[model samples]
Target: MQKAPERLIDENGFRLDGRRPEEFRPIKLQVGILDNPDGSAFIEQGKNKIIVGVYGPREIHPKHMVLPDRAVIRCRYRMAPFSTEERKNPAPSRREIEISKVIREALEPAVMPEYYPRTVIDIFVEALQCDGGTRCAGIVAASLALADAGISMRELVSACSVGKVEGQIVADLFDLEDKYGEADMPVAIMPNLNKVTLIQMDGKLSRDEFERAFEMALDGCRKIRNLQAEALKRRCEVLTGTEMPEKGSLEAH
Candidate 1:
């Protein structure tokens, strides 16, 4: 088996990547980037590329599962055949199922499901390229897609990952670092309320290190929330042919 690359330059620095101990990679997001879906978004953070599509509040099939007083959020997460270093099979694997469940649960609390009872909202996320933190990327993309669909939510959902590599805590682990790094922690947060909706971690961390990584991830989440909001505003302006009126401008109208 090939050994993982050594990523620690020294006890206190990064290897070749320019990121500091608690820095995230540059992120880019585009909303309504797809033509076929009711809502869509493309997101890139580091080497990870994910596209998400949301459809729904339409009708429920296999009708037995429809609820009487709330809509159901159905989520599917998949990796494209060439998304990874190794080609993946064309079916949803157990890992994808697990991630879909986690993502659905993460956004469930934020969605106003009672508004569309007996309807189904379908969200599909495809990993176009894989690095670390694909699940978190999926969550972020899904939130944007939902917003693009004009679904009411308590707040936007944003996510980021942090890790420990080379004995130092870091934010937003890239592909190589995640493969060889000591610990990886991914979190989804509701920035408006400073609350966490999703959290997961692997590897070892002392209490101090955990606190450091948690703080770093939360900061990243806030940064991502800003980006998501900007993307949504741009999309709305394009779709409506009008800019968002400045705050309280409607009162003048």
Candidate 2:
């Protein structure tokens, strides 16, 4: 581990970047940005940039791998060579493989796999930049891409990471904080259904601290969910001349 900076948080409780414990980095979302993919979306959160493309509900290739009762969901997560200060190898790393699988399973609960039996839904997530929380950001963009593709889903999934930094539970951890933090916990949920699709932790937290962090993460996801709705609404406006829903306006805007 890299040596911790003298302080990750100042006396005023502001983070190194000047954000409060509950604040997230600025986030931007764009949906249906690609012409060829069945569905696509992009997300920029803090310095993490990711694009997701979805294809399918089409026939599954190599028939034997197909499930008779549901669609097969596959996800590929890759960080571009230029994504970070150090050039990443083009070949998928074990971390990429693991993150891809985590993202796939996280999204599966929201998708109605039974609606497209024997078909496949492939999600491609490309990380153009990295700071932290790339996996959660990928999950956010992938859910939007799947929706843009017209896939049947119970609800859109949203995700965020919270951690104990400098003895404080903080929301939306950035790269440096996660590096030196005591604990990092990521959570994903189908907000509308109040269902948790994924939860993973690195390091450890006390029971009370973990509960607080989990709730903080959920609040962040709900905020992101509102942003997702706004993106879809904008896409609808452009494509079909639909008006934005007043009730769906983002809380943090």
The TM-scores of all predictions, comma-separated, are 0.92, 0.94
Best by TM-score: 2
Q: Residue 101 of model 2: what lDDT?
A: 91
Stretches off by above 4 angstroms in model 2 are 1-4, 242-253
In order, what lDDT does every prediction score?
A: 0.86, 0.91
| Candidate 1: clashing pairs of residues | none
Worst 10 residues of 1 by lDDT: 244-253
- Can you tell me which runs of candidate 1 are displaced by over 4 Å? 1-3, 10-12, 242-253
| Full-model lDDT, candidate 2 | 0.91
- Mind sharing the TM-score for model 2? 0.94
lDDT of 1 by residue, 151-175 (tens): 9899999999998887888888877
lDDT of 2 by residue, 1-253 (tens): 3456899999998999899998998888989999989999999888899999999988888989999999999889999999986788999999999999999999999999999989999999999999989999999999999999999999999999999998899998988898888999989999988989999999879999999999999999999998998888888887896655553433342
Ten-residue stretch with the least lDDT total in model 2: 244-253
